[model samples]
Structures are given as structure tokens and as C-alpha cells.
Target chain A: MWGGGADMADPALRPIQRDWLSKTLAGLVLGAILALACSGLFARLNTAMPLGVRGQLAMWMVPPVWLGVLGGVYFFSSGVRAWLWLGAASAFVTGVFYLL
Target chain B: MRSEFVRIYKAVHTWTGIVAGMALFIAFYAGALTVFKEPLAAWASPPVAGRMVPLADTPKLIAGVLAADPATARDFTIHMGDAEHVPGRMGWQVRDTDADDHDESSVRHYVGTLDATGQARIEASHPSQLASFIDVLHRVVGLPVDSDPNRWVMGLVAALYALALISGVVVLLPSLVKDFFALRLGKNLKRMWLDAHNVVGIVSLPFHLVMALTAVVFAYHDGIYIVQDKFVHDGKWGTAFQRQQPAAAAPGRDPASMLPPLELIARAQAFAPGFEPTALQYQQVTGPRAVVRVWGKDAAAVSPRARGGFAALDPYTGKVINSDFLPGRQSTPNLFVSSFFALHMAAFGGTAVQWMYFLLGLAGAWLFYSGNLLWVESRRRKRPRDGGEVPAQRRDVRLMAAATVGVCLGCVCGISLTIVGAKWAYALVGDANAWLLPVYYTTFFGCIVWAFLQGAAKAAVHLLWLAVMAALAIPLTSGLAAVAPGLNMWVNTSLSSLGVDITACVGAAALGWMARATARRVRQGGADSVWSEGPQPCLQGGVPGVGVQAK
Candidate 1:
């Protein structure tokens, strides 16, 4: 029924349709790890700013950005790429955050 | 014409929407009702509330509460129930479970008003926590009662919810211009549902964004605050807004030395001009650290909390002591933070915005519900209605259909029926508020079981009846109260109270209409669906026992 002339009913695409379990694990784990570390790092970067505005801004910015990162992961060109990109990005950010 | 990224985003939208749609539905539905929390609370409170002791005699009532219980002398408040709606109320803490900790939600409060003889009598009897109950349901989904784990659960769900919003927008972007308002209502049911989902979602994107971001902040504010404290300020942020202690009360200094509540409100005006006093909360009224936080809002000032500007006054001299976050007096950064909060809470805008947010909330609920329906529809088995062998639907789709009907309708019927119980069944229980929890949980799980036993079409009709019955009970209970015996008229004499009845009637009418439409869909609709008369009724006529009739 897809207008693309290739439906998900094709045997080649059935496996992708059934890949929900792996996607869930990747989304939950990679998504959360990146979200927390990135929010913490942003708040840290803003410590030099006057007043407590940086902290307050962190609260508003962190969640949306986290979800953006998650969207980036899932919207990658391939499922394998989605997993690899999310894993590498999450590790790099978290490792750098601790190192800095 | 869609790109690979758009295709991937479509999958992301589908998955995240499936994950978060149900919880989001409950949150949005209850959250809509919570916009008018004060009015709902006023409507549900007993008539005794309307008799609040006059502002002229508030000090006398205060003195009485202090004298009746020495512990109450620690902290008491004069609740400024507007003379028109919720008059005659004062509150005091009976016992400090956590000593000197004033702001914890767990503290037991004793609220009452003065009697005819002008005596401060503690009215221990309360009608129902209808408003607060609904607000609490919006915050936490009634599993573990707002513990940290629950907050984390909701917070993570919010993260997923945010992902859903992002992906949904991405998928809709390429066709955003031409198909923005295109609602093709003809043969394609999926197209129509998708359009409705997309239209509602796109229109309310800002509102949903604020909700998602704010939910994350609210849920993990403690952790975020800690991160700020340790990393940002080297643990010095704890003292950022700390108020300097007042001169210690001399031994034998009577608390009667403190200024009256009116004088405190007047002094608060010196800090925030045109401050409309709503409530005055006094902490440590008799102790050396006694402070009276006068909560009033200057309508001219935009505040984040629904409550107006706050001024912590020196109770003894009626002098303004703290004004850092007070509306019209807050610092720029503080004001920005407060403005963000006010945006989410809709505290800045008046009643019109409140109504707008209410409609937005209901629309949000519809978006989630329809999302779930679209998911189930996507996987429904295809077959002819007249005859031939039909395959079973996907287990996941069947389960989602049951859950979509069960959890969402369960929440609606639960809240409605509990409020009905609050109105009519209070006399039967030891505590009406306590009684509603059971009423909600029972109905919630009961609907889920029923949905599984009977499939989508039949379950939808029955559960809708339950929803209509529960909703109708609200106005019905109030209407019967006026004419019935043993139930003294608890309706407030104000038009606001009557508006609640009207709203309930409107809600019931909507549910009734929904029920009728669902029944119509079961008969003579497309039989190539689970919602239609498919197998267990694929034969020429219908199912043996069940009521599925095929043409």
C-alpha cells in the first residue's frame, strides 16, 4: 500500500519492522546517558556566568537537547549506524565531561 | 519524495508515540481539569467554607487557634478566600512531623473558620479533595505516590515524549507546506486519522514543548539543583536566596507583639504596589524565627506561579524582609526563571488563557489517543466481511488496542466516578478522599480486564457508557443534592459552582456522543479491520454468542 512502490510487506523489510526490541534498548540507554552528561556539562560551562541564570537555563535546555540527540540517533541512514553513532557520541561526551 | 532521514523519523515517531502516548493522555486529560484547580476546589468544598470569618475579625480567630493548641503557635496562616467564592478559612499545622520544616507537602494541616459566636472552631470535617486529587493524578500516575523513583519514571517518559515530538515534526516537515491544512476526509481512514493527529500536534507544538521541558525540570529539579550546587557554585548555591535571620526573640517576648494579618498585607504593598493579597502564610508565629510570607499578586506583574507576588514580612514590625523572587521586585535572572515557570503554569495570563490551556490539554489527550488508534489500525488483519478465511491480528496490535481503550478510558471514567463518589458516597466512607483512591484503581484495572475479554468495538461502547455514566453522575449528584433529604445543600451559591455542573453536563454529553459513534462504527463499517465485524464473525452472519452481525 506504500506509495514508494516498495511496501514493508516485502520479505526484505520484515526484519526491520520487527526490530523494535533492539531500538528500544538503544534509545533508552544511549538516550539517557547522553542527556544527563550533556546537561551536566552545559551547566558546568555556564558556571562563570553571573547570577544563577545558567542553572535555571540548564533546566529548560537539557531535556529538549537530549531528545534532539535521540532523534538524531534514530534518524541515521541505517539502523547499525544509528546504534554506532549513538554509542560513540554518548561515550565521547560523557568521557570528556568527566575529564574536563 | 521523502528523504531517508524523513523515513527514519517516521519510524522514530511511530515507536516513541507508541511508548509515551498512553501516559501522556492521562497527564494531559487530568492536567486540563487542573487549570481551574481553585474553582474546582471551591465547588467541591462544603457550604461551611462560604462563611469565612470576616477580614476585620481575622486576628481574633488567629489568637483562638494559637490558644486552642500551643503547637499551632509555631505556625498558622490566614487563608484569603475571596469573599465571593471561598470565604471563611484559616489553616495551621497541628504537629510538626519534621521540626521547623514549613514547606513540605506531607505536613498535616488543620483548616477551619470562626463560628457564629466569633469563636475559632476547628472544622475537622472536609468534603473532598477533588481538585488536589486530580492535580496529583496529573503529576504522578497513581502508582507509588510521587516518590523519587516515580518522578524518575515520569522524567524518562518525558524524555521519550520529547523524542516523539521531535521526530513527529521532522516527518511532517517535507510536506508541511502543502499538506499543512489538508484534511482529506474521504475513503482513507488512516489518512484522516493521521491528518487529525498531525494537525492537533503541529498546532500545539509550543504548548507540548513547554510541557515536556518543564516536566523534566520539575521531575528532576532536586538533582539538577544538586548539580548546580556542587559543580556551578562549589556548593555555595544553597545560600543564594537565604534570608538573614531576624533578631532573636527575647525570652518571655509574647508573640502578641506581632502585627495583625492586615498590617502585613499593607506592608507587603510597600514592596509590591497594588498587590492583591490571596493568602498569608505565617511560619514560627510564636518563635524567635517567626516569619509571615504574604502571598499576593500584582495583576500588573507577571508571575510564574498562579499565586501573586510574595513578600516575606517581619511579623513583629510588618516590614518587608525578602523580595528577591517577588513579582514586580524580582531580579532579572529570577524574573526570567519565573517567567518560564509562569509560561508552563499559565499563571501570567488571566482566565482566558486558562481556558485556552484547558482546550489545549484536551486536544493533547486526543492527539495521544488517536496516535494509539493509528498504531492498532496499521497492524489490523485484512479480510472480506462476507466470508473466506481471515488471519489473526498481530498480538501487539490487539494488546495495544485493548490498552489504548483500557488505560485512557479507565483514567477518564476513574476521575469522573471518583468525583461522583466524592459528591454522593462520602457518608458511606470514613474519609471521602481516601475512598476515591480505591474507586479509581478498581475502575482503572476493571476497564483493562473488560477490554481484553471483549474486543475493541464492543469494549469501546461499554467502556464509553461507563465514562458517560461516571461523568453524568457529577451534575446528577449535585442536582439530586438540592432536592434530596439527609444531604444538606453543599452547592456554593455562586455561579462558579453552577459552572462546574454545566461543565460536567457538557462532558457527559460529549461522552454520550462518543459512545453512539463507537456503536455505529461496529456495524456496517469497513470489515477489513479489527474494529469492524471480522473474525470471530467472519461467517455469513455473525459470531455465535457475541453480537457481531455481518452484512
Candidate 2:
């Protein structure tokens, strides 16, 4: 039944019979990591900076993160590609946040 | 199964967007301007010197006033002026129970200045009518007081806005990536509108979502009360609401003592280590057991809502009774609420955040405007020449166009005119708020009527030009009215006036751009006739050559 249904499934999912599952899982992991990192940075800024400056940072942080993620998802060639790009971007943002 | 869910969400998104788009646009546009309410209020008041008073004198003056009137002492609120945004004046409201056997309120303002002993002295100034007018507009969108209908309507609109936002996210899930950074300008009308909508929606999605949700929260908090009563509290909504209420002080019978004001202040400071006390309230001043309430501001707090780190002190003994810190269970939610407020008011970050929200708000407004245009464009070719046999769809489009242009641009012009009217009213009538607030609504309604008659293209062009011209003239008008010599001196002396003038100039520039665009459209002869699939004469008897009779 699995094999029969597989034929009707998305073409993009065919690669998931082997290594693609790991990548998809990794992408999900990366997304979580980035969300946490950004949230943490926001928290720190809220506590460390002046109320006004923190507010400004929050305004800036919200737009880019939300837009970037949404844009990456929509503009990518395929669902898998979208996920991969999202993962990479998330990881990169997380790394940048850590450094800051 | 996944695709089925996606399709269902898409339908929901479209319907929600179409239903709530116009109302959301109005809310956002007005709300963005409300961030600078204080500055706007200041702009309305004429510049006056010797407004600032020493903090120490506030307590003594308050004590003296309370000593004279026993009832005023029980429930009193202090008004502190921001140096940049507010005039240095201490205003108070006293509730007189003796008059009419009910609470009769009186508003008195005192000019804050230092005396020979370096203490703050109180004197009266003219009442602020302009500020109150702006406040009403910001809170109620110029709704008539007699009609309770407007509140429910506004509340319903806020709910619909939330629904629309949710639907928007669901719809964008599919194409969010392809159009993420894609703001392809100067293209097919539909495509351009779609791109613009997507970019603005995605960029400001969180801000918009928070705004929509919180607006509903504010407007329909009563709904929550009802819900909690019916469901959460098992028919005890009143009790739940009461639980959230401030605790009343227990009655005390000890003899009154002369307490040092400095001792109370010192105790309050120690209670909230990091916060600065903005106001100190002595409850039942002559009574034996008086409660001194100290309201403090947290330096790291983003909004006024979050700055309420309070301490209640025993006036005579200089001992702390109670304090309000962010509760553990509610800290996150409270902070979220505060941050949302901060973002909405542009109070968290300085000018940069304010500018960003302002720009995005304008873009969001445009997005709604374009969305309406797109809908009109889609039906234009199919519309009939005569009013008779008009399809419901075409009628809907016409109404939407009239309303969208009328209300949005009308609000801009109305608000600007209100500010100017406020100043004039202050100078002439001495009570600007009474006449000025009415003028705002009258102008807004008049603009709507004008838009309805003029049609979208002409109304858009004319209003844009008028607004631009009016805004640009504001600074010059203000300067001419000023007794001061130079613009710099005016700005330095009165920050509120300066801010208003600068804002006016910016508003004028924006309107000018809009005016130019509208003119180009007029010159192009109504670029694409909505009624016809092909290019037809602008507004020349509905879709030409389409045989579809009006439904």
C-alpha cells in the first residue's frame, strides 16, 4: 500500500526514500534554533538597553525575521528547497545573534 | 489531504481579507498617528514659559489642597508634564460627593514654578481642549457619544481584522517564498497590487497581527468578562473581574499625625530600587491611617503600561505596605502586552521606530487602497452604463471605492484640519476642545461626502493636493502666529510646536507625491476602464460594448 501510494505522492518527496529525511529533519531543527536565538536576543536587549532603544530594536527585529522567513518560503523553487533555505538562513541568523 | 487543507485555508484567507481589509486600513492609519499623541497635544497648546515645577513642591501643594477639601483628598490623580511633549503644569481632578449626592468633578491646572525657597508653586492655566479632542478621535474614531452602536461596530471590525490577518497567513503559506523579496513595480495592475499587498503584509505581519489582536482585546475586554462569567468562572464573571481589581485599603482609626513628605518618598524609593517615582498620592490626608501611593517608572520598561512599578507607603511611619512587581504567572503576558503597546505607540524606540511604523502604516494603508482598486478594476468592464440593472458585485465595488477613498484620505485631511482648528480655537474661543473635536468629525464626514460625489480619481487627486498644501503651510502659519523671532527659537522653546511643524512638512511631502500620481492618472484618461476588457474612455458610461446587462 505504501509503495502504491508513493507513486501518487509529490515528486519532490521521492528522494526521501534515503538521505532526504535527514535533511528535512535538520531543516526543522534549524528553524527552531533560529527562533529561539532571535527570541533570546530580544530578551537580552529588553533587559540591557534603555526602554526606548529596546523598543526600536524590537521593531526592527520583528519585521526582518518574519519577512525573511515568509519570503524565503514563498520564493524558493520547491517545498524542499524552501525548507533548506529557511534552515540555512535560520542557522545563519542564530549564529549572528550569538556573536552580537 | 494536505492540498485539501491548503485550498480550504486559501478560501478563508481571501474571504477574510475581502471582508475586513477596509476597516483594518482605517484602524492602522489612525493608530499609527496616535503614537505621538503627547507631541500632538503639545502642538495644539501655544508656547508658554515657566511650566516646570520642582518635584518636592508637588507633595506640599497636594497636601495643602487635600487639607482644605476632605473629599478631594480621598481620590486624587496627579498630572506630570514631560519637558519635550507636555507643558509644565500640574492638573488634578477632585470628586465632590457633596454636590447632587454624586461625584462632581472639577479640573484645575496650576502653573508650575519655583518659589523663593526653591519649592514648586501652583497657578492656573487655560484648560486643554485640543488634547482631549485628539484623545476622543484616537480612542473612538470620531464616533458619536449618543450611539452605543459605534462601539460594537468598532469592536466587530477589530475582530474581523484579526480574522483577516489569520486568513492572510494561511493564504501566504504557499507563495510566501516566491514573493518574499519580490516588489516588482510598474507592471500589470493586478500583479503589482498583489506584490505590494504581499510585501507589506509579510513585512509588517507581526506588527499588524499584534495590533489586530490587541485592538480586539481592548475593544472587547467586556466580552472576556462575559466569557469568564459564563464559562471560566462558572457563572461568576463579576467575581473574576473583581479579583483583578485593586485592593481597597482597610479603614484605620488611629489619630492623625504630621508626617514628613521626604520620609514617605525615601520609603517608596527603597521599596522599588530601580524605578523613579513620578507621583506620590496621600490617601485620606487628615485621617489617622493615610496611604501614600508612589507611582514609579522603570528605566528599562518600553511603555507606560509597563512602567507601573508601584509602592504603597505608610505616610507617618515611613514603612512600605505593598508593592506591585510583574507577577510571575503573568510576567510574560504582561510584558507582551506592554511591548505591543510600546510598538503601537512608537514609544519603545525613539524616532527610528516611529518612522518605520509610520512608513509601514502608510504602505499598509496603500495596500488596502490598492486592494479596493483591484476589486473595482476586476468588475469595471462588466458594469452596466445606467444605474438600473446593476449587478450586486458592481454596486459593491462602487460603494467600496467611495468609502475607501473617502474615509482614508478624509481622515488625513480631517486630522490635519483639526490640529489647525485646535490652535485657532484656543486663540479665539479659549475652549478649543468643544468646537475643535466637532470640526474633526464634520471635516471627515464632509470629505467622505465630497469623495462620494467627486468619484475616486478626482477625489484622490484633489484631496492629496489639498492635504499636502495644508501640511506644508502649517509650520509657516505657526511661526507667523508665534511671538518669537526664529523657527529655531520656537522649536527650542516649545518642542511640541516644533514637532508639529516638522510633522506637517513631512505630511505635505507625502500628499504632494500622491497628488502627482493622481494627476498622471487623470492625464492618462483613466488608464484602464474597469467595465471593458479593453481600454475605454475614463468614466464614460460604464464598460463600453459589454452586452452584459446590469444584474
Candidate 3:
């Protein structure tokens, strides 16, 4: 996970002061998108099953999946890439569901 | 850790823990007490002979109630009296007309109790809101959920909490196996705190995971259900669930001919062995097909969710209609969902489990408290032992210390005081519910201001004493009332009442002990520490420890 900085370890934890506002906001937005997309993905997979089965599995699965995606976003080295990737995934899913 | 992942995770763990610690402390502490919600409720409202109706006499009482509130024939309950839920009474549920048919809602409730001469008397009943208040405090202590949009504020916190859990485990991975049980009581307070905090955080990881994830679902269940109903189900929830019907009774059977209370309990036992019906609810009493819901607990069932297993029966024919939620008869999906509810509510395994949860809850609260302490300690700059000044950068620690002491202790005291207030509330106010907020907020804010003004070390001893006094009042007021000539003799007769008194006494004793321990720590601890009252590091600035760097 160490990139470019040979001397230092875990550059991510160095407490970057500059552009913190942007990073925080961006992380929040991207995390939310990824969470929603993951939930929709679970829902889509369960579509062939009965409604009760779908509901049950969704209840058991969705929250953790959503939370996992949310936590996963903070791992990225760059906030811009995190936002861009999550935003793109969200759009792709939204379009797929919209068409269906 | 040698890798950057450790450092990054360390930051993540630190930030998430700091952000969620305060709310989680309230949640865990209140949640721990909520395990005994029924006992607490009973303690709040002691039973009187007038309120308790014998099971054999309930039929006559129901007849009388039907005469008084004929609407009750449609839907009512003969609240089976017990030790935990004192004062057996009857309830009439009024439903909202506009809500969706399956989107169940009971708009208003009126309760009936028998008078001395066997007539039914009804009142606008208010179940003491103290247990519920504590439960809500456990859920959304900082932001009031009622005012929050989408009601997802708790969900967001839960997400952060999950992150905290993950990152915390990550940071501890280096020493996870080696230092799991090491409780070093050396001079290094930070090491001791870290060890203690990590042990608790790791040991209770399963419980915390269940709570955090379930809390999110609970907070966002409405939205999730909507997605499932509209998008997933495509508006066929009723069809998908395959609602079952009774085999015995036909339509238009008279509810008046329904099996009596005693028989209902007997039949419920037949359906599920050892199913003890605590409450008999008659639903749709006005409609053509009225049903009786025999709600109670089954000793054999594993999950401990409140309300236990129930079988909806045809009141006229005593035929079991819906026992899907019954202990022995749950579907695979039902069992799965039931397990979650059971774990979330600690509804399974009875009193012993409840006690375990209560202790773990207290431990969880301690973990958060120590997390904050570690944060404050991390920033404490080292200085020479020769009375030399350290940097003034200790103000953040000072403020955080004050806030941590103030808000956390304030919640603890506020709950205890409110329980004490229950002894006097109904007698004092026309609107008793109105008094609860004022009583709690007054103590909570007062403690906060006091902490800031007097500092955390000074306020800790005082607040602990206040907490002890407040908790003692719960048992004392009731115990002493027994000696009074005019006060009711019910508390003297009930074990639940005595249990509440005894538990409160124990809690008060614990608080008293904590106060003494804290006072000693304040008096004798290190000089450069925020907890220390020895001497302010003679830094350049007037500030105690905000920014003065260590030499």
C-alpha cells in the first residue's frame, strides 16, 4: 500500500492537512454511492427468487454489504479516484436497474 | 506495524473511535439497562390490587369492558399480569384508517382496570416512558431521530462504528495473538489503557457487530422495506409471503363465542408445548372475522425477543391460525430473522443471558470511555521532571476530558434521577410525560456546565456522588414508602419491587465506589496528566496543556 514514498511508511496516515475538506466530502459521497450500488446488486441477484425469499435474504445481506462498501472507500490512496470509480459504478447500476 | 496499512488503520481506528465513542457510550450503557426493561417498567409503576385482576375473573371483567367500551370487542387485550410486568390490565387498540392495510399501526391506546366492586374503569393510560426513553437514548443519543431527515443518522453512525470495528481489529493485528490478555498494570498508563481497550474491543467484537449492524437495519428498515416492496416484490408482498388461513373456523363466527382466557392459554399450550400465554389480544373484534392472538413465551424456544412466540387463533373455534412465529414451528427464514431479533434484543436464554449482556454492555461503555482517555493521553506532551514547562497544546485534552466526564456521567446520572423522579412525577404534574424531558435535560446540562467550569477531575467526584444519590432514591423512596401509614403496601408484597430496590441499591453502591476511586486518582496521579490535579505544567501560555511542546 506504500506508493512512491520509500522512506516513510503508511503515507495515508500522515494526517494530510491540505484539501481535507475535499477528501472528507468526496469520501462520504463515494462511500454512499458504493453502498447503494451494492444493495441494488444484492436485490438484482435475488430477483428470480420468491418475494419472501428475496426479502429475507436482502434483510440478512444488505446492511452488512452496504456497511462493507462504505468502509472500503476509505482505503483508496486518492480521494479523486475513489469518487470517480464509485460514481461510475453507481451510474452503471442505476442505468441497469432503470432499464429493467 | 512495519507496513503503512497499520499506520493508515491506526488513523482510521483513532478517528472513527473518537467520532463514535460518545454516542456508543450512551447506547451501550442505556442498552445494558434496557435488557431488564420489563423489570425497570415494573419498578416505575408498582402494582396495586385495583390494577391486578385474577385470570379466572378476567372473563367477567371483559364482559363488563365490552359493555363500557363496546368498540373494544373488535380489538382488546387481557394483559396477563406477571412479576416483570406489574398490574394486569386490559388495553383497547385504535387503528389509523388512512394507513395501508398491512402497514400496521395502532394510533391510540386506552387501558381498562377493574374497580373494587367489579366494574370496568377506563383511563387514558400512559405507560411510564422511562424505559423507552432509555432505549431511544441507546439508539440515537446525540441526534434526535424524530427531527432527523430519513431517520438515517443512526445508520450513518452505525456505518462509522463498523469502520471503527474493522480498523480497530486491523491495528491490533500486530499484537492480536500475543497481547490478547495482557493487562499490564505498570506506570505506563497508555499501555494499560490500550491493552484494556483492545481486549474489550476484541472480546466483545461479536456482540458489537450484531448491535451495530442490527442498529443500521432498524434505523433504515422503513426505507429498505420500501425498496423490497416496490422494487423487489413489485407490489406483491402479500402473495409472496403466502398468508395462511385457519382450517377450522368458517367466516361470520361470533367472537362472543370465542374460547375463554383460560381455555385460550390451554389451547396455546397444545399448539406449542410449554407456551405460557402472558397476554390475550382480541383483534378485529368489530370485523366479521375476529381473531385472538395468544401472545406469550415458550420455555423451549432459543431466541429471547420480547413478546415471545404467539399463535393467532380463531376466537370462536379455538383453532390455531398463525403460529409462524412460534418457537418450534418457525420457517427457515423465520428462524434466521428471529435469531437476529433475538440477538439484538437479548431475548433468548432468559435471566442469565440478560445479566451477561448487562455486564458486556457496561464493559462496552468502559471501552469507549477508555478510547477517549487514550486519545487524550496520546497528545499529553512529555516534559522534564524538574517543574519545567510543557507545551500549551494540552487544551484539547482538557476540553475533551471535561466533555467526556460531563456528557457520559450526565447520562448515567440523568437516567438514575429520572428513575427516582418516577417516584414523584405523576403526583407533581398534570402531564407526567412532560416532566421527563425537563428532569433529564436539567441534570444533563447542569453537569456539563459544571464539568467545564470546575474541570473534569473536580467534577468527577461530585457527579458520581450525584449519580449515587439519584440511583439510591429509586429504592429508598419505595422502601421507605412501605413504612409510611398512607402509602400502598404493594411494594412490600412483590419480589419484583424488592428486586428493583435491591438492584438500585447495588448500582448506587457501585457509583459511590467509583467516586472514591476517581478522587484518589485525581489526588495522587501524575502531574503532567489531564487527570492530574497536582500542578498545571508551567507552560509559557495561560493555557494548561494546549500547545506547549515537550523539551
Clashes of each: 4, 17, 21
Best by lDDT: 1
lDDT tens digits, residue span B1-551, model 2: 13433454455456555676666566556665665565666676655655455555655655555444445555444444455434453444433334321111133444344556655455565545554454445444455331235555765565555555655666677778877979776735667667777777788788776666455455544544443334223453344212232366444433135355555667766655555666565666545456677665554455434234456676667777654332111244345545655655554445566678767777777766666666666566333544444233344555566677778777778777877776667666667657765777787888787765665667777778767866766676677666544422233346655877887897788789878876776566333442222222123235446343332
lDDT (10s digit) by residue, model 1, range B1-551: 33655776788788778888999898889889888777777667665544657777887878777777767766667877653334346775554455433222344656657778777677554435777778777876445265677777778777778888888898898889989877788677888888988899998899898888888777877886776566545677666555566566455445666787778888887667777788888887776667788887665676758665578887888877777558778877678778777777777657778788888999999999999988887677776666786656665666678788889999999988877777555545435667767888899889987886676667888999999998888887777777774675455556767777788899989999999988888786766666764553222233357554443
Q: How accurate is candidate 3 locally (lDDT)?
A: 0.71
For TM-score, the strongest prediction is: 3
> Runs in model 2 with CA error above 4 Å?
A1-100, B1-15, B47-53, B78-89, B94-126, B142-149, B234-276, B281-293, B302-312, B315-322, B325-360, B380-396, B483-492, B530-551
> TM-score of every model?
0.84, 0.68, 0.85
True contacts kept of each: 0.48, 0.00, 0.37
For candidate 3, write residues B1-551 as lDDT tens digits: 34555776688888888888887888888889888787777777644434467778777777777778777777788877656344446776576886433222224557777888878787765556666667667767543223334236767777778889888887898889999888898888889888889889998899999988888887777676666666555676658665555466455544456677889888888878777778888886545567788888764675525657678887767889877667666767667778888888777766778789888989989999999988988888766777786444476678888888998899889888877776576545534455666788788889888887677788888899999999888877777677773543224336655677898899899999999989988898765676766434222234555464444
Q: Which stretches of candidate 3 lie over 4 Å from their true place?
A: A1-50, A77-100, B49-51, B82-86, B93-109, B113-121, B142-151, B237-253, B390-393, B427-432, B487-493, B534-551
- Using TM-score as the yardstick, the better of models 1 and 2 is 1
Docking outcome class, model 2: incorrect
Candidate 2 lDDT? 0.55
